[model samples]
Target chain A: SAVISQKPSRDICQRGTSLTIQCQVDSQVTMMFWYRQQPGQSLTLIATANQGSEATYESGFVIDKFPISRPNLTFSTLTVSNMSPEDSSIYLCSVAGTSRVSNEQFFGPGTRLTVL
Target chain B: QQQVKQSPQSLIVQKGGISIINCAYENTAFDYFPWYQQFPGKGPALLIAIRPDVSEKKEGRFTISFNKSAKQFSLHIMDSQPGDSATYFCAASTGLGANNLFFGTGTRLTVIP
Candidate 1:
């Protein structure tokens, strides 16, 4: 299992402002992912943060709105730019376990952003 | 298109009873299915998972039943307790190239005493 941590456990930001969430893992990981959980909703994959190259984003998401940076194997950051009421959600970072036998993904505590 | 579909957005079960949540996937390429449990103010944690090669896998009181032909799976919690109450999510992944996962909406479970 991988131990994951996130910064800014909870933040209240003004509309139109941007917030950058950080994720760090205890061990080197091959893949890091960013996810969003809206109020009363399930987890939505935001993007896959690649170590050396650009992140792979899912549909309905883009790099312009949610920029991701992965400088190394153990660290990555996701920025929610030009925030709005719709952007107020819990952002989480996750890492798949290193063991090839297990595909389990461990998640961080999550950064809860409230846009006012 | 939603790759995974879950049923019973919310469930209420009595203590000592069984709580079951079901999910179905549209993609035949999905080879790995996992269920996650999430509590308020917390990120999801993997509860149990099953590969298409297996029909079922059990861990303690939690069991995952997978039907490859039906493209469906379900989570069964035996002897439900109040502490078991939380939101559960079903997700699928191809486990190939990138291994990006597609998650379902979620099921809120309440175990009443």
Candidate 2:
């Protein structure tokens, strides 16, 4: 299991503003992912942040809206660009387990964003 | 396409009762099925998981029942407690590709005293 932490645990931003959430893991991880959970809704994968490479966005999500950066194996960031009221949600970062012994992925505390 | 679907948008169970949340997936390629529990103002934690090869898996008070033929799975919480009240999600992944997971709509469970 990995210990993941995110900065700015909660924030309130105005519409049209952008917020960048940072995720840092205690140790190097093979996989890092970003997910969004809308109000009262399930989580949706925003992208897969590969170390030293461009993040892969999921369908219905584009880089323009959610730009990601994974500069190293233990850290990544997701910036919600041109934010809107609908974009207010909880953003979480997760890392895949190192070995196949357990496919369990550990998650960060999450950043709660509220756009007004 | 949304590969996974979950039922019971919300559930209310008395203390010491049983709470069950169901989910179904369309992609047969999904080899790993996991359930996550999230408390208020907190990120989700991996609760329990099962593979297609097994029908059921248990850990503590949580249990997962997998049905390969129906392409469905469920999480059963035994001896529900007030602390167990939280949002639960079911997710599936192929474990081969990029390891991206498809999540089902969450089920909010309220364990009443």
lDDT score, residue B104, model 1? 92
Q: Write the per-residue lDDT of candidate 2 for residues B46-85, one digit (tens) a residue.
A: 8888889999999999999999999999999999999999
Task: Indicate the TM-score of model 2.
Answer: 0.95
Best by TM-score: 1
TM-score of candidate 1 restricted to chain B? Answer: 0.96
Clashing pairs in 2: none
Per-residue lDDT tens digits of candidate 1, residues A1-116? 78889998999999999999999999998889999989998788999999899999999999999999999999999999999999999999999756674566778999999999
Work out the TM-score per prediction: 0.96, 0.95
DockQ leader: 1
Sum up the clashes in candidate 2. Answer: 0
Q: What would the per-residue lDDT of candidate 1 be over residues B12-88, giving only the tens digit for each residue?
A: 99999999999999899898898999999998988988899999999999999999899999999999999999999
DockQ of each: 0.64, 0.63
Positional deviation of A47 in candidate 1, in angstroms?
A: 0.7
What global local distance difference test value does model 2 have?
Answer: 0.90
CA-based DockQ, model 1: 0.64
